[model samples]
Target: MPKEWFKRVYVCTKPFMFMVFLQTSYAVKNLVVKSALNKGLNHYIFAVYRNAIAALFFGPLAFFLERKVRPKMTISIFLKIMLLGLLEYVFGILYCYFKNGSEKKTLNTERIT
Candidate 1:
């Protein structure tokens, strides 16, 4: 019974565990970036290195895993994807303009401590 209960708990907690892992990773990234900047690393250079590292890690996974099951891009699907991306920024801009434009303030990024 305990073994079955453990398996159920693992399945239920998988997503929450992943969420915590991602949040922890971002926190570490921020700390490392701040430290590198303090030690004279250019932000742009750091960004390039970060992207390169990510590509190195995920590029193989994408190529191998998605090569078989990837969907073909269609014009309508492309436009829908682009629109979905723009909607977030458009709404954000409108909200910032309407909400705090007078004060020149916006919540572009939330710094969580």
Candidate 2:
């Protein structure tokens, strides 16, 4: 029947649509950051504020949504999350270092000329 055909098409396109939406979000985020940076936003402060806002938004949802079923925090779990956060920040630092270093070079050259 046409209903079955429509259901099959919807199921097949669901993941493809989700991926397109996700990619569009990432592209938009990058575009916004690039525009802000060009307008003199400090990357370090931007990174901190971005992370802080994300935590503030998601932390409560996580705490409330999973509170009933979540396991108690153990030291090992705490340490593992800490280590993972540290690793993520380390990559952020490396990315900022290389990116800002290149930008600085261009800035210095512009000043000299």
Candidate 3:
């Protein structure tokens, strides 16, 4: 009975543990980013480093997971990826406008022209 109980505990996936881990990671990331920005980290450099880190982690995973099924990498696909990355930066401008504009509108400080 003890052996069976141990096996059950070992095999059970502790989803709660994963949730705690994910939330803690998010908190730490937020704290680090806020502190760095408060210390005057350049936004451009921060964004580059963030994306580079993401790519370093995901690029290999993508290569391995999709290697057997994905289409061959070609110049067109490479160019398209570059374009998509560029388009992603447009969100930075959109974020600024929405955040700033909403604050001003809420305060009745400026009307959109």
Candidate 4:
């Protein structure tokens, strides 16, 4: 019974083993990224690199895996994506500026009193 149980546990398909490995690697990568952020790595640069690397890895997989069903990148779609990205960037900058500005004001008041 123990031997049968062992075989059952160990007899995973290749795709199952690959998924387990992928998830473990992703968890470890997140831990390392969090450690780097805590250590004061430049977050903007980190975000850029993270997004670029993700695109680099996933782009090919998407191209190959979904080539048959992937929707075409029309000019309208491209323009919409660009516009959305620009809006997000502008909003992020505004939010950060306001957030930091408030924090600075509080910090300065605390220092004064």
Model 2: number of clashes? 0
lDDT of each: 0.89, 0.88, 0.85, 0.85
Model 2 misplacement above 4 A = 74-113
State the displacement of the C-alpha of residue 32, model 1, in Å, after optimal TM-score superposition: 0.6
Tell me the tens digit of each residue's lDDT in model 3 across 25-99: 999999999999999999899999999999999999998998899888899999999998988887765676588
**Which one is best on lDDT?**
1
Tens-digit lDDT string for candidate 4 (6-75): 7887785667998999999999999989999999999998999999999999999998999999679999
lDDT of 3: 0.85
For model 1, what is the error of residue 110's alpha carbon versus the real structure, in angstroms, after optimal superposition?
36
TM-score for every candidate vs. truth?
0.62, 0.60, 0.54, 0.45
lDDT of 1 by residue, 1-113 (tens): 99999999999999999999999999998999899999999989998999999999999989998997988899998999999999999887878767874424565654445
Question: Per-residue error at 64 for model 3, in Å?
Answer: 1.6
Q: Clashing residue pairs, candidate 1?
A: none
Instruction: Give the range where candidate 2 is weakest over 10 consecutive residues by summed lDDT.
Output: 103-112
Per-residue C-alpha lDDT of model 2 across residues 1-113, encoded as one tens digit per residue: 99999999999999999999999999999999999999999999999989999999999999899999987899999999999999998887668657876535533533233
Error of model 3, residue 73, in angstroms: 7.2
Look at candidate 1 and tell me the lDDT of residue 100. Answer: 72
